[model samples]
Target: MPPLSTAATPPPALRQIGAWIAGLRRADIPEPVATVVSGCIADTLGVALAGARASAGRLVAADARDTYADGPATLLAGGRLCPEGAAFANVAAAHALDFDDNCYAGFVHGSAVVVPAALAAVEAAGGSGSDLLTAVTAGTEAQYVLADAVGNGVYHAGWWTTALFGAVGAAAAAAKAGGLTEAATADALAFALCGTGGLRACFGTDAKPLLAAQAAAGGVRATRLAARGLEVPHGVIEDPRGFARLMAAGAFDGQVPATLGRYWRLLDPGIDTKAYPVCLSAHAALDAVRDLMAEERLSEADIATVRCRVPPVVAANLTYDRPVTPAEARFSLPFAVACAMRYGTLGLEHLDEAVLADPSLGAAMGRVAMAADPGWNDDPERARRAPEGAEVTVVTLRGDSFTRFCAMPRGSAARPLAAAEHAAKFRACAVLAADRVPGPAEADRLYGRLRSLDRLPTLDGLLTP
Candidate 1:
């Protein structure tokens, strides 16, 4: 085979990104942006602690202990490993429950992947809270901006954006925290993009969070390698045989990258905190279902049938109608809707075997039917406005039907959760891993530390058992 051609100079977008990543500081981050990122960090760590109590989380943590040599980076579950290993284990745990935050830029689980990588890198480098905040900002913007540049076509094309673009984002975090230069940071991103990819087919399986963890770990590895003078093609994102062409199907927007620092995607199309542990696609419907149930005071026996009209993406992601496992239930609209109808709310506790085997829940799941909204694609503006929105209808046994539409769920950026609600979520998750922590008081202390991440001098003992 002939020698492969390489870009003689870095793309303008890549060069700009490198400069931004190299110069980003906590002081430069906007107050609002810092607050949003801090919330994501707090939420991610809280869920990661709970996730460690999960089977997948426990297995991954164990593997990290056995496979990676000990290092300074601390796992949220409890213990130390190399930065890459720690990032991998912690991220897996954070996402194992599908409760982490989401971003619409690429329809990716941004913080679940970015925050853990930033934490691991900062801890390994003995960096301060400010460093962690800056690293997270850098990583989040890098991934979201790149996703914006390519649009969501890649995601619609059956690619898992969290794993595809998350590696590059994670690398940006690691590089920023490690104090790598602009050029090296750019190279690290390129290496990460070149090395990472995942299929959407992994959505309902353990592979989903496992690939997320692997992407994060790969990113940390890429940054360390680049810091040690490793170099890769700089314009790989726009190269003919590179990311855009191979992954995005040649759907590249050249202008999106130029808006990197000026347009903070993290704030505008902001982070979405998930109130439910299930797929984000199901949140809107669940919100609507619960609302209708409360308004009508309809018990499970009062509902006769239910139908949900959702955007194509929602219908596509929530594929399991009669889920048998916890993983499947997280991706199943039927399970989420059924649980909501039966209990008025769905939480981590509802994933227990006893809950899953409930005859009423199974019957309720059977009653729930999800179909793609015919008009979803007809109106470009509506589709853009609510890509994952849902219209839910509940029919009572008395032959009366009520319909509710939810453009966005409660924890979404448009309708954010209150501080108290966020805290409640954190405490709930922390309690799940009570055996690892002292008690509710320690969990509360940790919550305070995580929320004030920007003020902490170091992450040395913040997540310690």
Candidate 2:
């Protein structure tokens, strides 16, 4: 193995990566990339609007008021906050329900991190809509690169890669939008490293949203600090005591920078949009459960036991081995699979406390079991098959059994939700917000405006009370 010191040298490719992102003019960005960025933006906005009423979102919004800035930026919720605060609040809201787009390369929520940072930067800098889209694309691409470099090392080490690597990507995006030089962008990234942290243990709690929020704020702070001439180690990312080495517990791979733009991580691997709001790892099991339910036409009462075979990686993150609360159920693979089997679908309504507390659902959830498939984890080829796929088996009281396997969860990049389904999801999320905000007509209009965010001249006009 190479010495850790060997990793400290800044690869020549780093400068080239920085330059490529900085050099992208609005018109220079590909139209497909721009359109995808728009879709991500719209999806994020819908999540934010829905999350604004969530408990975590409200708390984050309140804390953000302390950092208030009288700017053109629109906070996802009703109030106005500073650029950093707005980014934090919006990102938190966007990720509150865990319904944002995920990048396969890094397994991070790309839109939640990039969209918040770009929107804040554009609003604060008085930038154009095209600038916002370009910055978002660049930021998302940067995140995927960093995530791919780390591989699954961070996850194996129990770090939430999204919050860890997301700070760097968010900082890069903000720095680009802020017109920072290559040196400045590197410095901003260094500053961001100081704020990086998140654990999978915090998944079911309000801390889940806080993870993304802190990353968003840290990104903005990094750029602002760099703009003021703050100094940071140029080789922070590659340094032994720095991000990659400290977080991944290994020497930096020389191949990371070489792959930066040679392959567009965003377009190549692309984004995975969640059909169900539960953990992405649980999606496959959910799909399998739903399949068995349909194939056997079994009612919840007829089932004796439900078992799911899943990858060890999924098993590791299913913190709620047996969940008692609605929040806990969201992270429990067993509970999610059971809910899918009994209810036939896992919708937002199913996550409600009342639904979780239902005796019938509780009984069904208790009957579900999850076991790790050593084959799935041991075989490198099979492990790469699908991050969220699983095999489900159901045993009935009549001594009959039903089984189903899912290679990819619904709404994944491989099996995307159609336009109508995406619209329905947005409408459902909008309804979550409409319940709190007055005037149903105004709320519907706001939803329409959010769907057309790319055309909006100013985000300020969208936040009317």
Candidate 3:
């Protein structure tokens, strides 16, 4: 294999991936695939609907109105906007709570990146429900493949893989829904590469949601530009100074198919739904805290100190172990662990300003410490591999110590949530949006429609204002 920095000509495989995404739109997606896609769609909407009333979501909505476009697509908060604006706003809303599903391949939030683009594109084209589902599957698969190709090496080089490759996945999804030709899809992909960039330093800021929104908007723009016969470099992905070369330390060595219809990666690996609102990497620590709480019957008053050992990757991304704000706490391993240990559950309420202002939570957060354990680096095969989980050791004032190791979080693929659990989560998140829609009956009706999304003739039915 050539060095990643080599200015190699565009490889045929790169174009083939783009062609493959184009082909997925025309291919027959199985019922199982459709069901999963529907689930993801419903899950994303529930998150968005809840987030629409959040501070960030409100700001995005206000901005969308200012940058007005004459289009039929509905921004999550209220009025209609152009497809790109809608995609941007919806993506921001979906991720405002950080509750969307994740793809471990590159640690990208699958639904956050793909769903908004799909919804906006499909709505703009007046596409059928089936068309929207197919495009989502294709876009999600493309994201996984690309993230797998570049995520690990890029993260190792201090890049956020989701914001980087998410543009390509979002573009691919939009292209498929917009019915772009293979060449157009390829060009759209290249356009996506030109617009791709995001930093981990912006993790705690509004920039995190903006990163998702930009990818969503940019992807739609790229596809629309491609559909208009715009030209872009064919070898943009593999060329020197291209995405893989500039953003990642490693080259793309994986065997991506030469044609678009080889295998559906969505069915192979599937998506991982999140049970918590915080970063997925912090999930293990939360689990460990939960376990210690249950086994040792530990209480805040009895606990003197909490120590967590996690993989280096998790430690690297969770730079703020003791954060001052809710957003900062979301990315803080120690803060999440401390909250889990103190409150016995980490939820939206826990992330509230009032909860964050709790003197007890702050003191507990201060007592928590995290260490990187080499033994936890168990995901050697994953693109962005990390330690398997966290080991929490809580020492009590009475000199009693309790220890628990979490290998996987509850909602992870290894321990998938049951349908009832998913429904419960949906209801819980929906409650947060009670003021927006203002009735249990309305929420139930929307939830019922989403649960049966595939049967609907059009997705527009689900977006009732």
Using all chains and alpha carbons, the TM-scores for the candidates as numbered come to 0.96, 0.91, 0.92
Q: Compose the digit string of candidate 1's lDDT tens values, residues 1-465.
A: 122225454355566687789988877888989999889989998999999888889888988999998999987677788899999999999899999999999998999999999998998899999999999999999999888888999999999999998998999999999999999998899899899999999988889999999999999999999999998878887788988888889987665666776779888799899999999999999999999999999989999999999988998899899888899999999999998988889999898778889987899899999999767979987786778999999999999999999989989998999998998899889988876666778888888888788778987787753
In model 3, pairs of residues that clash are: 20-260, 376-387
Write down the worst ten-residue block by lDDT for model 2.
1-10
Error of 1 at 287 (Å): 0.7
**lDDT of candidate 2 over 194-306, digit per residue (tens):** 66888877878889889888998898888899889998766666666776778778644655665554566766677777888778889988887777777778777778988
Residues 1-465 of candidate 3 have per-residue lDDT tens digits of: 113433344354447677777667434676777777788888888888888877778888788778868587877787788888898888888988888887666767878888888888888888877777878887887777777665466765767767777788889889988888788898998898788888778876677887888888888889889999998887776777776677775477545433234444455555678888888889988888787778777777888888888787778778886677777877888778777878788888888778877888888888889898765545554312333477788888999888887777888766778997777777777767765556656766677777675566777756652
Candidate 1: the clashing residue pairs are none
lDDT of each: 0.89, 0.76, 0.77
Candidate 3 lDDT score relative to the true structure = 0.77
Measured on C-alpha atoms, candidate 2 has an lDDT of 0.76
TM-score of 3: 0.92
Global fold similarity of model 2 (TM-score) = 0.91
